[model samples]
Target: MRVFGMQHIGFTVPHLEEAVRFFEAAFGAVTCLETGRIEADDAFMQRRLGVPAGCRIENIKVLRIGNGTNLELFQYSGEEDGEEPLKRNSQSGGFHLAFEVDDCHSAADRLRQAGVDVLEGPTFVDAGAMQGLTWLYLRAPWGQFLELVSMNGALGYERAGGPKQWSPVTGE
Candidate 1:
């Protein structure tokens, strides 16, 4: 079978409750499922999650933002070890999750006012129809990378005789 769109994006955090608060306060995300301690070191954990033996995955939470995407956030505390947390987008395997915003500059200001470390804001493009697009990158308190993009009006493809990008609104 062919794959559709994304179902969710999962990541483990140092603090589960704090991450929940951040998602709620920052992106207006609501909790869909709140799981209690899930201590397991058996085959289920090892086979399904690769959570090796002598380890425990206690607190787990799931949050949903706009669109149909879900963020599966987990807090790990156990004997099995993992690498230390790194800065936002610090390595080749690092990536940032982006969200669509109505306005870039204003959102950047709002994030700055919220005490988030603003990496860059309103990095506009100087090209064809993409001139209207604006992007901003910001970092969470826990060092997770996030990006903001505003896609409106006609873009480069549309101007170049190409079809517009698929969106929930236009459904093109």
Candidate 2:
């Protein structure tokens, strides 16, 4: 089998409502579908979802962000919930999501106005494969690391005839 494109990314959050609201208010994400609370007294939860037998999934929401990406947000309530602390990018299994904006500076300002914690630079890369790109990092309310990125025209690699980078704005 061969891969085509990404369909969605799943995130297990502490509070479903808060995550939904944050995505909607901060990034204009729209809720497209919801699978209400799911639970089982038997081993179905374990066999199917790989959760503990008595574990319960409080809710699942599917949201669409910007032009394309879809996010599947899940909220769980069980004995094992939140047993593991969130990880940083430097740690194993740690990851961050990046959103492409028209202007990185304006996006950072909007995030600051929303009282979001802006972490690192909206810094520009001077002479590299990523030349002309500006990016910054921020933290979501639930502590997920996110990035804001912007690029004008094409990148250095593209200008040098390397493979084109995938962009939501250009659909490439």
Best of the candidates, TM-score: 2
Q: What value of lDDT does candidate 2 attain over all alpha carbons?
A: 0.87
Best by lDDT: 2
Instruction: Give all candidates' CA lDDT scores.
Output: 0.78, 0.87
Candidate 1, poorest ten consecutive residues by summed lDDT: 163-172
Candidate 1: stretches off by over 4 Å: 79-83, 87-90, 128-130, 161-172
Per-structure clash totals for the candidates: 0, 0
Deviation from native of the Cα of residue 170 in model 1, angstroms: 5.3
**Residue range 124-171, candidate 2, lDDT tens digits:** 987788898999999889899999899887888888899886789977
Query: Per-residue error at 111 for model 1, in Å?
Result: 0.9
Model 1 residue 13 lDDT score: 80
